[model samples]
Target: MELFTLSLPAAIYIFVMAYIPMFGVVVAFKNYKYDKGILGSEWVGFKNFEFLFKSETAFRITRNTVLYNIGYMALTTICALAVAILLNEIAKKWLKIYQTAMILPFFLSWVVMSYITLAFLDHQSGFMNGWLSAFGFEKIKWYFEPEYWPFILNAVHLWKAIGFSALVYYAGILGIDGELYEAARIDGAKRFQLVKHITLPQLTPLIVILLILSIGNMFRGDFGLHFFIPNNSGMIYPTTDIIDTYIYRALSEVGDISMASAVGLYQSFVGFVLVIAANFTVRKINEENSLF
Candidate 1:
């Protein structure tokens, strides 16, 4: 009774914020008419989903979305784990300072980050251009070029996101028993050996869990990073276009609520399946570590 009472607020919050909106998934299968309303709309079966798959932007956006997310998952996991290990080795005096500096960027709004990105990449008065021109090199328009965006976006994503991911791994490290480390040291294990055996093994479950969550969202791009960092330059859309950004543009420009809902539903369904599959695989390997 006590536990049920404690969870009542969270249940209400989820019902209000999360589960309630799930009804909108029906719009994905309907030829939604605003005047007719959601329930009154005519069912269209898979027609809306067909439009998404057949559209020219479909392949490009889907490709970019999946590829970018895969790259991010790979890079961020490796980098964050490295950073977390490094942080774990820090002494008490400097650990607090290091942690504060690392987490500061995670708290900044993407809008603020957009401006910061613009300041450095702005064509005429930007820091990069200024430095290049000072060295007698011709100034390049950063936003106009699509070639540089992959690296630029990845770097910015790492900068903005690594702090939080690193902290998660840091917490995972904290949960590890100190006795393992002490035993390693008593056995004359070197620092690198201890990390290779003790730290990495202990962190595998957390790493796998995070990886599964990341894979579940593979089709969903970080809209703020893609939209804001590139400043929505049409020329760079070839490379930077992702499902979320594409859907946002469709929503803002065409006001196609049905299409937007369809895309979102597609993403959700795929994510749901992937998460289930991932959890199942985890269960097969180690039942206790499975999310369910």
Candidate 2:
């Protein structure tokens, strides 16, 4: 009874926020009209989906979404693990300061981050250009160049996101039994060896669960990061354009709500399949580590 009472608010929240919104999914199939309303709108079956798949930018957006997500997941996991391990090794006196500094970026909004990026990347008066000039190099138009965005986006993402991920891993590290480390030390195990054998093995299940959850979002990209960071430059669309941003443009520019909804539905379906497949593969490899 106590547990149920404690969870009641969360249950209500989920029902309202997550489940209730599912009814709008029917909009994906309907040629949604303001006057006719959702139920009264004409059913177009798969027409919206067809329009999405047939669009010229569809492939480019989809490819960018998937590749960027893969890169983000891999880089975030690796860096988070390294950061967590380092935090675990730090002296208690300085641990809190290091943690506060690293985790500060996680709280910053993407809007703030975009402006920070602009301050550094602006062609003429930017910090980066100033440094380049100091070194006798020509100023580069950072936003106009699509080639540089992949690296810039990844770096920015790492800076903003790694803090939260590292904190999660750090908490997991804290939960690990201290006796295991003590025993490892008694066996004359070096720091690297202890981490490789004790820390990594103990954290495997936590890592697998987080990875599975991340894989579910493989088809979705962070819209704010891709949209605001590059200032939505058309020239950079070749690399920065993603499904989320594309859907936003479709709705905003074309006002094709049905098409946008269809694309969103497709994104959700693909993400669901990826999660299931990833979990299945993990189950096959190690049943204990499987998410479900």
Candidate 3:
């Protein structure tokens, strides 16, 4: 009875928030007229999906979304693991300070990050341009260029996300049996050898779970990061555009709610399939590491 009571609130919240909203998915197949409402609207079958599949910008957005997510997953994991290992070596006296500094960015809103990026990247009266002038170099227009955005976005995402991911990894490291490390040291194992043979092997299950979860988001992009950071510049769309931003533009500019919903549904479906496939592969390799 106590356990059921403990879980009751979460059950109700999930039913109200997650399950109830699922019914609106039907809006994707409907014309979604304001007057007719969701269920009352005309069913157009797969007509709305055609907007996404038929558009010339379709391939560009899809490629950007998948590539950006893949880059984020791979780079974030590597950097986070590295940072976590480094943090484990820090002295206890300064550990809290280092943790606070690193985790601060994770809590900041993307809107704030966008303005912070603007301050540095602005062509005139910007820090970067000022440095360029001092060094006798041409001032580059950061927002107008698509080529530089991939690196910029990756750096920004890392800055905001690495702290939290590192914290998770750090905790995992702390939970590791200290006896293992002591035993390795007694055997004359170097620090690198201990990490390679002991620490990494123990952390492999956690890494696999996180990776599988990240794979689930392979079809989605950070909408705010792509949209606000570039300030919605058309010139940079070739590099910065993703499915989430594309759907927003479709709804806001074109006012095609049904089409936008269809694209969103597509993203959700693909993400779901990716998660299942990833979990299945992991199960085949190591049943213990599989999310299921």
Candidate 4:
């Protein structure tokens, strides 16, 4: 009774804030009219979904979204783990400073990152162009070029995300028993040998769990990065466009609520299935680390 009373407020809060909004998912199937509103909107069965998949841009946007997320997840995971291991090796006195510097970028808003990125890549007055011109090379229009965006976006994602991801892994490393390392050292293991045999093995379960969670969101894109960093220049949309940005453009520019809802529903449904499937695969390989 005491526990129930203690948890009552949280239960009510979840019902009001989380579960209640699920009813809006009906909009995904309806021809949502503002005049009719959500409850009164005409039911269109699967027509909205049909339109969502039929558009040529749908394929392109879906491909870009999934591919970018996969690349981001792989790169970020590898880099973060590497950074975390390096930080763990450093002397304890300098650890806090390095961790703070690494994590500062994660707290900055994407809008702030946009301006920082512009400072470096702005074609006419930016630092990169100025340096190139000083070297007697012609200035390149950074934003206008689609080919450069893949590398640029990957670098930006890594720069902004590595700190947080590394911190998670670092915490996992710290939770490990110090006795294991001491034992390994007494067993004549060198530093690299200790990392390879002791540290990496201990961290594998946490790594697998994080990787599975990341795979679940493989279809989702970080809209702020794509939308703000490139400044939504249409020429670069070929490479930068993703489902979230596409849905935003549809709602704001085309005012197509039904189509936008359909796309969103598609993304959610696919992500749901991907998570379940990924979890199933992980459980098959290692039951202990599976999220379920």
Q: State each candidate's clash count.
A: 0, 0, 0, 0
Q: Number of the top candidate by lDDT?
A: 3
Error of 1 at 254 (Å): 1.5
- What's the CA RMSD of model 2 in angstroms? 0.9
Q: Give the alpha-carbon lDDT of every model.
A: 0.91, 0.93, 0.94, 0.90
Model 2 TM-score?
Answer: 0.98
The reply for model 3, stretches above 4 Å from the true place, is none
lDDT of 1 by residue, 1-292 (tens): 9999999999999999999988889998898998999999999888887767988988899999999999999999999999999999889799889888988888998889989988999999999999999999999898889999999999989998899999999999999999999998999999999889999999998998888898899988899999988999999999998999988987899887888888998898899898899999999999877778
Each candidate: RMSD: 1.5, 0.9, 0.9, 1.6
Q: Candidate 3 residues 1-292, lDDT tens each?
A: 9999999999999999999999999999999999999989999999999998999999999999999999998999999999999999889999999999999999999999999999999999889999999999999999888999999999999999999999999999999999999999999999899889988889899999999999988898999899999999999999999999988988898899999889889989999999999999999999999999
Per-residue accuracy of model 4 over 137-227 as CA lDDT, tens digit each: 9998988899999899999999999999999999988988999999988989998898898788899999988888888788879999999
Put down candidate 2 lDDT per residue, 159-260, tens digits, no spaces.
999988998999999999999999989999999999999999999999999999999999989999999999999989999999898888878988988998
TM-score between candidate 4 and the true structure: 0.95
